[model samples]
Target: MQKKAGPFFYVFLALFVFFVMFPFLWVLLSSIKPLGELFGDKAFDWFTSHPTLKSYVSVFVNYPFLRYLWNSTVVATVTTVYTVFVAAFAAYAIARLEFKGKTVILGLVLAVSMFPQIATISPIYMFVKKFGLTNSYLGLIIPYTTFALPLSIWLLVTFFRKIPFDLEEAAKMDGATPMQTYFKIIFPLAVPGVFTTSILVFIAAWNEFLFALTINTAEKYKTVPVGIAMFQGQYTIPWGEISAATVIVTIPLVIMVLLFQRRIVSGLTSGSVKE
Candidate 1:
């Protein structure tokens, strides 16, 4: 039997939800408000006296926001696909095959993930510049993949390790080749983990700011974050427009998480205990 939550539990949960959601609520409010009301004395009011979609419309009309969205979509989608594909193979090898220096390799992957992006940015920028990839999709995609791989690999290794070795043995007994066994039997069973990793990597790539800003300086290649950050004026900042753009950028991620949340939860928990 399970115990029911008391008043204190409900209070704490409500408070925690509010604490996590207040920033988004504030941004949403700001997006709907007119510039004067957004910046003026009634800025913190819970409801705006006059809510308008002018800011949202201006985002599309005055700027190349659609192009930025498209750029972000392409970069993030490609990065997630490439990172998960490579991580899948690397993780399968690490989890199933016996190899020397396996521990060292895993440790190195963790170390690379923990390495400060700021510390490595200069060299990455130089490398991209040397390859003449700057101001291009590949420029951002490469760095995003580098940062995204370690976590994806780690999560996938956990999932792959949880798959029964007997399955592989059975496939081999049936005269299936190694590639056939992996693609047919092992990979399908690990789909939940793969989906989870792809979502995380995609979100990271979409929201990445520093590498996008540094590597893709041209207006045509700028992503959502870089484009949003570049929103400015000679006399004042366009807070309403900025907020509107932020809301627009965040909606897709929210919808994705909501739709696939069950898979994400199951994927994360499935590998926690050995069968």
Candidate 2:
């Protein structure tokens, strides 16, 4: 006979799922509510009110929402692309190449990942200013890649280590150069890792608030997180508009996660599997 899940197991699972999803559901529901009805007195009034797209329209019309979205998309996409290429090569070297102090190098990479982004913000700002990169795509892109590289390299290394060296040897025997072998053989096999790293780097760059706020002073150059944060003032918070912006910024990420869910699962599982 098939075993049934224990009572407490089901209870805990339900609670966990609810805890994870409640905020997203609340935001989605709130996004569609009318401005006045959003914080109405009735407990479930927000749910019962007629929905409107005014807030969304106002966001696009009143602010440079499209500009911010475009900036974020460009930054995130470029960062993801650059990071994958650099990290994949670094990971391949660390995993497959015979090098001295590999353990020390890996440990240093981990240490860099552990360093909080805030701790280096001042230095990063100074560097950006020195290069006249502030408010430019390069400004955000450089920092995003720096912060993202460590984790991306580490994860790719883990995945690359699982791939057999015999594949590389076989490719070399067929007169394939190292670059050709990596491009033709290893890269195709490392799709799961590439997808995982790209998604993470994109999300990090997309949702980054602190650096974007500090570096990109122009409203047109600001990312979604910074744009969302500036959606209200002290005296009157436009909850409707804020909710609408939240929904707008959230949809792309949600779609990306859904589309690459299988690759994400495979990447996570790859880390656990040995050869």
Candidate 3:
């Protein structure tokens, strides 16, 4: 029989949860604090005497924050779709196909992912400028897809390899074409991993700042991160507004994970064991 967790285990777990959640709780509390209270003597107090929605109101009214949010949604959604599509094909090929230098190719992909964006940003910017793609969705999409591809491919390859080859063989014997086999058989079985990869890719694209700031300098195309950064003025920073925006931007992602956490956990662990 498996052993039950002891009191110390529960204690440790509680501490871990506190460590993870304290920052967010502080930010949440800060977002609702009145500006005077935010800078007052009791600034570090857990709860404020005066709480107002003015910060949240300012986030929407004082700036074109809605447009910035829409821009982020567009870029992140498009980047996730194409990145997953292409990664699926590439991963399927690597996992199923017999080819020369397969290991080397995988290694190269990982190496490319490890390359710092700072090191390559200059060349990427020049390339985008040359094609007049700067300040466009395609410009950010191209780079987001590039950076996200390697991780997605790597994760999907593991899941694909976990699938039994006998399934593919059985499909072939029934006169199914390779494409049909993959679409009807392989793809459905791999949905968990695909879903997990999609969430991760979307988060990465959503939170991306350097490329978004660099490639899309046009105010209309600026994403949430850039928009939040711009909340600072000539001599003052709007801490409450920034905190409110942070809470607003983070809630959806938090809810998404909470809803799909089971699938995410299963997808991550399914490929861990050998069949």
Candidate 4:
């Protein structure tokens, strides 16, 4: 007979899922509730009572939300693209090429990734200001790429190492140059790793609050994280509006993860198995 999960295992799994989903469920339900229902003494009742999209409407109508969205999208897309491209080449070299001090360079890359970003923010700010990049997409994109590159390269390197070397040898035998081989052969095979890195870098850049708040002073240049944080005023916190904005910002990421769930799982499993 087939064995069933034990009671404790099922109970633990149920609790884990509930814990993971509770915050998202709360934000979603709160986003649809009216201000009165959200703030009323019987606030819990808001979940089942009249739901409305007034808060979502207010967010766009009362704020430069579209500008924030656009800035975030542009910065995130640029950062993700550049990071993935640079990291792919760097990882390919590290995985497939041999040179002196390669191990030392890889160790340094890993060490740099471990350093807290806050520690270098001041220096980064000064460098960006010197380059007159503040409040510009370049300001955010450069730093995002810098921070995301190390991890992306490392992760891609791990996956690239898992690929059989014979494929590359076969491609070279067909008169394919290294660049052509990378584009035509290796890149296609590294799709899972690339997608995994892109998702991670996009999410990191999207939710980045500290650097976005620090570097982008103009309201028009702000990202979603900074915009959402400043959505409230000194006099009051618009919980409904904040919650609505949170839901909006979160939905895209949730959808991306859901759509690429299989790829992410496969990528993670591949990394684990190879390691």
Which structure among the candidates has the greatest TM-score? 3
lDDT against the true structure, per candidate, is: 0.88, 0.84, 0.88, 0.86
After superposing candidate 3 on the true structure, give the runs of residues whose Cα lies further than 4 Å from its correct spot: 265-275
TM-score of each: 0.91, 0.89, 0.92, 0.90
Tens-place lDDT per residue, model 3, 83-166, is 899999989889987899889988878788787889888988999999999999899998886678887887788888878899
- Model 3 TM-score, all chains together: 0.92
In candidate 2 the C-alpha lDDT for residue 199 amounts to 79
**lDDT ranking from best candidate downward:** 1, 3, 4, 2
What lDDT does model 2 reach?
A: 0.84
Judged by lDDT against the true structure, how good is candidate 4? 0.86
Model 4 pairs whose backbones collide: none
- RMSD (CA, Å), candidate 2 to true, equals 2.7
Please report, as a residue range, the 10-residue window in candidate 3 with the lowest summed lDDT. Answer: 266-275
What TM-score does candidate 4 get on C-alpha atoms?
Answer: 0.90
lDDT of 1 by residue, 156-209 (tens): 888888799999999999999989988999999988778888887788888899
Local distance difference test, candidate 3: 0.88
Worst 10 residues of 4 by lDDT: 266-275
Relative to the true structure, candidate 2 reaches a TM of 0.89
For candidate 1, the clash count comes to 0
Q: lDDT by residue for model 2 over 157-214, one digit each (tens)?
A: 9888777889999998999998998889898988877788777767777888889999
**Which of candidates 3 and 4 is the stronger one according to TM-score?**
3
